[model samples]
Every structure is written in structure tokens, then in C-alpha cells.
Target: MKTFNAKVNVTLKKSVLDPQGQTVLEALHSLGYKGTENLRVGKYFEVTLNAQDENSAKTQLKEMCEKLLVNTVIEQYEVHLS
Candidate 1:
């Protein structure tokens, strides 16, 4: 088996409301920054996997994302394998 590294990014769907992001934006505005606009917050995950090939590692990472890493109801994920 080969060891691979995976980077996962989880973000709220465009339609979803991000209260944390809004709060940050408001804070920035309060700090006198006027150029800030609609802000969104997300998560990042880095993992190591052992598999036969890059494809296999990616497949496993996808499963891992769907099963535990992200909330399917409100989040979308992008995966990078290296």
C-alpha cells in the first residue's frame, strides 16, 4: 500500500446562511473596513491514507468525507489527493 495525503475543504452551499461569516463581516465593518462583502466560512481537513493507488485513496477519502467529515445537508466538499 502507498501512503497518500488528502486535503478536504468543506463549505456551506451558496443557498445556506452562514451566521459566523456574517458576524465576521459585521465586525470588520464596525472596524471601519467598508470594502468587505458577503462572507462565507468553511473548514479544512488534512488526512493520510494508505491505499493501492491514487484512485483508491481518493475513493476512500470521498467515503470518509460523506460519512463523517461533512454535513451533507448544509455543506459541500472538495477533495485533493497527493
Candidate 2:
């Protein structure tokens, strides 16, 4: 087996309101970052797992994303395996 690294990015769906993003945008404006017009908040996760190959790594990542990394009702997730 080989060890692989997976990077997961989870974010709220476009239709959902992002209060944290809004707060960050407001802060940017207040801090004189006038050029910043928008912001979005999300989560990132790095995981290392054992797998036989890249395909196996990806499969594991997909399962992990579906089971624990994403809230399907309101969020989306992307997985990158290396």
C-alpha cells in the first residue's frame, strides 16, 4: 500500500447565506481594503491515508467527503488526492 494525501475544501452552496463571509467583507471595508467587494467562508482539511493507488485514494476521499466532510443539504465539497 501507498500513503496519499487528500485535500478537501468544503463550502456553502451559492444559495445559502454566508454570515461569516459577510462579516469578513465588512471587516475588509472597515480596514481600508476598499477594493475587496466580496468574501466567502469555507473549510479546508488535509488527510493522509493508505491506499494501493491514486484511484483508491480518490475513492477513499470521495467516501470520506460524502460521509463526513460535506453537508449535502447546504454545502459542496471538492477532494484532491496526491
**Top candidate by TM-score:** 2
Residue 76 CA displacement from its true place in model 2, Å: 1.0
Model 1 lDDT tens row, 1-82: 9999889999999989999999999999999999998788999999988999988988899899999999999999999888
lDDT of 2 by residue, 1-82 (tens): 9999888999999999999999999999999999997788999999999998999889888988888889899999888877
Question: Residue 79: error of model 2 in Å?
Answer: 1.2
Q: How much lDDT does each candidate structure score?
A: 0.93, 0.91
At residue 54, give the lDDT of candidate 1.
Answer: 89
Q: Candidate 2 — worst ten consecutive residues by lDDT sum? A: 60-69
For all predicted structures, in order, the TM-scores are 0.93, 0.94
- Backbone clashes in model 1: 0
CA shift of 18, model 1, Å: 0.5
